[model samples]
Target: MKTVSFLTKKLGFGLIWLLLGLGLFSCEPDPIEIDLPAHEPKLVIATQVFPAKYMVVQVSKSFSSLAGDGKEMNADTTFLKTLAVEHALVQINFNGQTETLKHVRNGFYVSRNIPQHFQQRYTLTVRDSVSGLECTAATEMLAPVNFEKLEPEVKRTEKDTTVTLHFTLADPGPERNFFLISLVGANRKNLLPKNKIGSFNAVQEQIILVNHGAFTNGKYEGKERLTLETSDTLLVSLSNISEPYYNYLQLYQKSGSLMNQLTGEPINLPTNIQNGYGFFSAHNPTAQVFKISER
Candidate 1:
């Protein structure tokens, strides 16, 4: 009598069948599907640059769940169309020291001689002339980031150029937070460095931040490495700090509402944007020279 073995003829046949199935699976193309929900708009009230910049809040009319849709609608025409529907204004009261506000193109107020500092207490009073609503929240500019080193980094590739920034603070849990980075002209002479780059007098070049970077940690103990292509110096300030109790962007943007690009959900930004100083070094170096101070 033949004894049945684990790898007997019958079992061998079964294994061969299984191997054939796995082979088919390997040969088959992986199922690839794209899923993106509808994208709500981000109410963006922005200024070109200070000292003669136009201030306007823009609301995106449409957004896609993925980059394709977002990229398609992010053209100049769509942005201009969005700006046509909103208004914005920023009023400041430094310890009840009233300052005259003027509305520029986007309802943002600018004065010829107004300065901001972390030491100076300030309150922002905004009036939505279009909706007849007002956002008058108050917060002084917290002391700017005290970076260990803020100079530019040059490497083999232009993209390797860097600005090492570090600060002292504990992490805000593990949930990630988003930060908006921008590089604006430090002076009037250095406007629009892209079209005519490499041939201009720049006191400090701006990196021209067009988007945001989301990170999991909050505090930078010593320094962090940021890689990019820049040709100017910058005054760097980062915000949109989602702490345990404070949501900055949600506090602002009343009309169009803030949309989560990831979730495609709408949020009424409390302050919308806690405007301080120095955004990211967009793509250049000397966007804004951020001066770090200490207590």
Candidate 2:
């Protein structure tokens, strides 16, 4: 009876050991973590000086991604999440209240009606989503800066059947100045600071020519023209677009591999500001627009 009892205990111990081994092997391996490149999107905030109640912010996907980079990622979930503002407050009008700014979509912000005040102050308290994050950048709002004028220089070449438009120096002295242009019949609100257009400002002065993107034959077929406007000037924006008007800077121009979708990583843009789309930020600058005429 004693020997039988001992054998029973041994068998029970053996069963327990077997179960433990199976459980250990059946467990899944721990997930691996890899550091991903940051999108470093740029942010552009548009609001001209007084009664200056509203703003239009812009962001462009870098150029590298435009050429094909990420192969397995959902851009909306990852890349757009990095849109210029991290954690910040934008003061629209002088209600002395900070609760008015509403974040619209990924890159839009609107402020509800605020009590009107002359020369009212408005600014932003933004958080940078970069790894070296800086959240509180409360810019002291005073009034909108005055508008700068643009004197465009236009030239034409008979041999190449091409025309070039250039600009003389603008005297917007510091403080992040920009020139806004309207192409022909575009509305005032549709105007943007000019630098976002493709390929110009080389050699002599800031010059541009109608290209294939603007038309099938690389020349304006009366589709666009430009009108320059400024803040702190008159009550309206000087508008522009299409004598051979090309398309506006679109956010959807850059797309890459579905492989990036496989991972939750923000699609890494391969180039810096000069080569890629300048990030979506107040700092992503747009220069003045120039036009070309046939020689």
Scored by TM-score, the top model is 1
Alpha carbon lDDT of each predicted model? 0.35, 0.31
Q: Runs in model 1 with CA error above 4 Å?
A: 1-71, 84-90, 106-108, 112-121, 157-295
What is the per-residue lDDT of model 1 for residues 1-295, given as tens digits with 9 covering 90 to 100? Answer: 0001112226778898778878878675676697746543322332222322222222212233333333334344545354332454554566556665565443244555345443455555555556444433344333222223334333343543334444333333454533333333232223344556332222223221211223224444433333323324345544332231133322221112122221223332333333211111111111236422210
What is the per-residue lDDT of model 2 for residues 228-272, given as tens digits with 9 covering 90 to 100? 233211121232211111121221122222222122223333221
Number of backbone collisions per candidate: 40, 53
Model 2's lDDT to the true fold?
Answer: 0.31
TM-score of 1: 0.40
TM-score per candidate, chains pooled: 0.40, 0.31
Model 2 vs. true fold: TM: 0.31
Cα deviation at 12, candidate 1, in Å, is 40
Q: How far off is residue 262 in model 2, in Å? A: 20
Residue 96 in model 1: lDDT: 53
